[model samples]
Target: MIPVTRELVTGIKLTNYKDFIVEHLEDCPKEDKLSRLKHIWSMPKFGQLPKKPTKLKLLEHTRAYLLYLVSTTIFVDASQRSTLISYLQLLRDLDEAGKYAWGAVALAFLYRSLSKVADRESHFSGLATLL
Candidate 1:
């Protein structure tokens, strides 16, 4: 472990900027993080969004970059830390279905897009293979 003054930073040592960003999701304000994530995911593609986004694409290459922020974070160990855990849990729980019907919408959009793409592009026939 790299020794600092007070806190003992665990996990793999950061050798670059991407490593630092990936390892520090708990440093930012939860609301700000969530707001940024939601803002990025707010795009509405109707049935045409084969692979769009749920919030503003903070990274040009990654659609749900905030998901990286969230996914990289772990709250199960710190179950009593803050309300952010609750929100994260809810978001996690939104796996199958939830209050926000966004998943359902996205699924339908994805199926439509995939069907259309497979029909037009023979090379992309296996929709799952494209992923």
Candidate 2:
């Protein structure tokens, strides 16, 4: 199995994530201009799920929820206002999503973030619960 990294979670390529966002959410307004990662979605947009959602809508809602969960918790960055669209590629097929080692990925991301904090006196933004 490939080692998990912040950018390569469960085989979802960074380029694909960028492509997905550019194709889908490029028009969406971004609040953080200093963020290194591009193509992020506003957190508030995915804050709630539809009350009466269709099949497709339900899938989208679940995806949004998972995105929020991971971004804010495990893979969080300094820009808390938006979420990385990279994880959306993995959420595209929920059934297959379970096959990925999510816990390992989260651990990897946390380690990576911690390393950044240790290397520099930067603010910690990932998995504070685990610390």
Candidate 3:
């Protein structure tokens, strides 16, 4: 087995962002988080859900939106947050597959952006290897 380095763990940490979103799903008000998530999701794509995102898509969207909120409304200096914002925008504009890909890419970008604050070497490493 490949040794689990901090580099590997960073990707794992990025996934935690999804969990964070799920945990805070109530932050957005649209009946509930799942409803808002489905709405945000279906806006860009019209098809069956992906196996990975079927249940988790809303939480992920919540996570992405939170990232936007923090990067813009808070004191965090996230230069790369725009990549995530752009990814979300693309999700709103692009077709289904493209939106899905952008969703994944948005998380990767947000992770890289956050790593700039907490861990630099690990952030870029995560971006190069994870996404």
- Candidate achieving higher lDDT, 1 or 3: 3
Candidate 2 at 113: error in angstroms?
1.7
State each model's CA lDDT, in order: 0.31, 0.60, 0.36
Better of 2 and 3 by TM-score: 2
Candidate 1 yields a Cα-based lDDT of 0.31
lDDT of 3 by residue, 1-131 (tens): 12222221112223333443334432332333222233344333323434666445655454455444433432133333232222232223223322233334335555766677475444332233333
* Cα error of candidate 1 at position 19, Å: 26
lDDT of 2 by residue, 5-39 (tens): 32344544464444464443333344334222332
**Top lDDT prediction, candidate number:** 2
Off by over 4 Å in 2: 1-8, 12-44
Estimate the TM-score of every prediction: 0.20, 0.66, 0.22
**Candidate 2, lDDT over the whole model:** 0.60
Answer with 1 or 2, whichever has the higher TM-score.
2
lDDT score for residue 97 of model 1 = 17
